[model samples]
Target: MVELLDNQRTFHIQVKHTSLVLHVLPTGHVTVIYWGKRLESKSLAYVIQDIGRASYISDTDGIKDFKLEQLPQAMPTHGNSDLRTPALVLEYADGSRITNLRYKDFKVYSGKERLPGMPTITSGEEVETVEILLEDYLQQVTVKLIFSAFYEYNAITQSVVVTNLSKSNVTIEKVVSSNIDFLDAAYDVCYLSGAWGRETHRQVRPLSQGAFLLDSKRGASGHGQNPFLALADKQANENSGSIYSMNMVYSGNFQAIAEVDMHQNTRMQMGINPFDFAWQLVPQESFYTPETVLIYSDQGYNQLSAIYHRFYRECLMKSSHAEKVRPVLINNWEATYFDFDKRKLLSLAKEAADCGIELFVLDDGWFGKRSDTTTSLGDWQPNHQKLGGSLSGLIEEIGQLGLQFGLWVEPEMVSPDSELYRAHPDWIIQVAGRDPQLARHQYVLDLANPAVQNYLITELSTLLEKENIAYIKWDMNRNITDSGSSYLAVAQQKELSHRYILGLYHVLEILTEQFPEVLFESCAGGGGRYDPGMLYYMPQTWTSDDTDAIERLPIQSGTSLIYPPISMGCHVSAVPNHQVGRITSMDTRGIVAMQGNLGYELDLTQLSTEEKLLVKEQVVQYKEIREIVQLGQLIRLTEIENQNQYAWLYRSKDATAFVVSFVQVLARANTVPKRLKLAGLDAKAYYQVGERICTGSELMSIGLKLDKPIEDYAGQRWLVKKIEK
Candidate 1:
């Protein structure tokens, strides 16, 4: 409830807790350099001061006096709980400014007092609990960065740094990824990733109107791929494990810098949206990303990717994981998209009921009177032609076949030609009489409508009651357009965007509660809808819709640099793919797919004899190492972006299992074979390779060699079945 520097140019201040709105400078800098939180009436006091104990300072290179220009503080005219964008802005001495700095790069230095009955913090005390308590340590947090930048049409290497001058070691983990809203003719998310390395990385797939880094590239390691410029090297070297990012759109800009220390266990994701810049995270050291660099782009995919690399080198940081993740997962979109009746579904269910396939999903055209992507959006009903009856009925049928049944829905959209739209014309988001705009030939539904929200909940709840539906595929295709809303008052217009997202959260929370067993996969036209906000509801996500396995190699490779493989959802689809039209080798395709939640997306009903046999063997092999792929340690043995080679590793959940994918992109003679020493093995046990057996140490020591050149860019998979004696 305090205000810092409120001016058109430079901003400076000290506060217990405050809301910020900083502007963007094109010099490649993080605008709001500081320290921060909360929702509704539930949020009261930001922080309490220790009284005469906590101090402040802006001392750094090229430092200057703090200035405050007279600026009117407009009344919100609504409850804080209703909606608000507490933005942060950064200004340079030379009259330049930028906004949107990562929360991770800021630091706080102050002593803490035990507010009677509350946990205490003291030096050398095994790190007592560190909470952003409303009554105590809120204001104690200060924003800082070793090297940062704010940019508008360009990047400038500016740096800010803050330290924990307090007596105890500050623990600052849990700054997760960001959730942002965009406003435009139609908002877009043109994203990119860094250089490719060996191993399978998920790719960024285009949504109807936006693009996102699907799969593993949504983390700090992933930021290396964002198409943004980096801070100068000397500045970036000021601290290790720091974060850098740029957020901009066709008309806006934001950037940030955060230096992370070992003592603080907090981690966060960095990125930008059209309207806002943010980082999301849980304040737990249990698991998170340490640092990252995020950027925005305007050009198509290629140009954006190059921009992402411009900022990659400066944001590099080594990443370990809470655990490895699954890479391959079977998607029903290719297998079946609103084409199956109960009997036909049952037939396909039997095909996917094998040991290799983990989950079987039914894609779009499934619910809400939706026969196609154009209608039945607000109406969440299963078309009789496809379902015959209830979704639950189909779920039960699939269960009988011993497979997990997954259903798809797009709750955030609506169609003018459908019942939901006609019933509540006001429920659609349009600029008054501006004739609702459309993307993918569809209009966006206003979840901002309580009536719309209730309908979605009612429809979703009714379906969940049918039987055990193991998974839900939440898909969103377009960005918001014609932002004016009839439902929200003028004062509450800003709330429309955030509220639309919140409304999504409310529904998801309810569904998750009603059916705790179901695993939700958020797919925003593949990755557009991807944000930490969804992760709060669904643990796993579909990385992208571009299923060309070869193009996906770089995508997945780049993705894994930041995300765990298990969390990535990849699939082996037919060559001459539906999108990219690339016909890669079946073995090469399966090899790429095996790095994820392994499953097939192509039609299995009409496979050729040899294809069927090959697929059968693959199914059997995947089943054998499923555990390792699902929850193991992932090691990228090759750098795909750097060379024509592929190599990656996954060790079992118990650390007892392991699998390695070695694809030689180009022939190499005496290229110093990379020896990936296996972990979690019983050195006590001997490992035999091929005809001749070798010690586990020997294999790790010498490794295998390819006999012929990997021409036509072909490869092989060495599945090591429990070290043979």
Candidate 2:
């Protein structure tokens, strides 16, 4: 709920267990007074009065108030006598760079409103909002700060809408989505950072007296950095203490910064990066920033993550497959690679269907003159030479076997040898006088160009219309380099990266809206672009290119910190794993992969009859518990480290069913059984486990013991169902 204490000049917004209090000072500048646990409606006027003395220091001129530098500003501005990191920076037509804003007005509403061209929380009666307006009288600019409070989630969504009200145009250098301040620096910053094939590794460091930045400028939410940051108290853990998190719902050039001022005050800001960025704001033109989610959890990191998971699962993902159980799919990428023919693919599909797999995805070899990585990337048509029949006929054959068909395409890449690229060499991103750099034997198409984007849309739409494709594995195998667009002017050339992301989002929006039934799984060389922005279009993303079970434990663990399980695409590949060459038990692989959208990557036709039976059983078991695994609350029972064990627990939303998956990493000479205490259960109810029944209290207090002297790489999965008295 959102309330305005007009008498005290304070705005109070509460959502579930969290509250945010903002006060308007006598100078009309807004500052955050308190943001943490839920608080009663009370006046904070005295708090403002205490800092009133600093408003006018004897050393400063009578016209300037030094207090603006001390107050915890809601949106700090540049050239306002405050030296902090400004949330709004602008350059005017007259060469003046001053921006001083004050509270103009505010409006309270019943439901949340969506931000244009961006992902945001869904609107409902349970959600409330307050939009506060701030204006710069000298520049004739208006800024609207929007806050949304969700009743079920301990989160407040924030965004900014900046409108130019002057007669001429203005240049916007930087405008952040949200800026928040804490009274003191008593927290540690936690973020996710890593490289390709080893993405989203968790890193935590203490907040010192300087600025710490977590950002991505690789034209995508690159594998090197993720757009998430959290500030947890020094004493915070998984279950206790105060935690503040801000995540940007954008895919391109983004920044998240935590700055500690001289007064020991800390300010956290997140939005689009200002480097190489300048937006032209014409008169009456409004620029809308992407929404940033702020979650306050007095209970700790797990509580903070739970709020994000619930919000994304219900609000961001818009496809029809968002709430449904995904099919147990088998992809032929690792199995056949670029060597599959019509007979080979049909054999694989037939075997996969017999093993109860619902879908078969033909990856990387079905289109163009493409048999290898060096050719035919831009061509989207089917290769009749390899298929030996019409594409629709093959799809019909697969459907006749009671299996769905999926195809893979790299729509944003073009090979130098391909027909499309040969015809239109200027379509790719490159400087006019330089040789375009190549990665993965391909050049990235300049999606920022309208012609290039339109061509791709036409090709993809034609294919989707011609065939009965149920799923699409959209892949982008290369990063952007030599970032210069031929269509943009010299001054606007620096806008290529951001414009590229906008173009990609535009294509996805139109395609997903037209074919809402098709399940789209995004892959940027596997998890490179696995972010909230992509999840808004595709419900799930391939977790990583490295499908090795042992390596995946840490990757999935760190990814789960910010993203939900339903958004991760995990696959069980062959032992002697293609990526890492590590041989792990198939059971261990299946158990690990089941924690995500479960699927298979290896050749099922090559398995022995007994192994095939195991595959069938795994498929059946996954079907029985798919709903709980996809929509349940996930609890990490064991920390992911270089230890002998890793475990996870999934509990139904209603607390009636739960499943625990445990894996023994390696064998030991002489070891005792490890006991794990489970969480999120009905303490008084009895649960049936296999043939035995135990009270939830016993499981929570006494714990469950693992099998002693377990074999290396052994895995166990246990299911418990609640029993009524």
Task: Please report how far candidate 2 places residue 217 from its true position, in Å.
Answer: 0.9
Candidate no. 1 TM-score: 0.61
User: Model 1 segments beyond 4 Å from truth?
Assistant: 1-330, 336-338, 354-358, 389-393, 665-686, 690-701, 707-713, 720-725
Q: What is the C-alpha lDDT of each candidate?
A: 0.46, 0.86
lDDT of 2 by residue, 481-530 (tens): 89898888776787787788888988898899988989999998888888
How high is each candidate's TM-score?
0.61, 0.96
- The lowest-lDDT stretch of 10 consecutive residues in candidate 2 is 52-61
Tens-place lDDT per residue, model 1, 495-538, is: 45545655665676677766766667766656443333344456
Candidate 2 is scored at a TM of 0.96
Off by over 4 Å in 2: 6-8, 51-66, 640-644
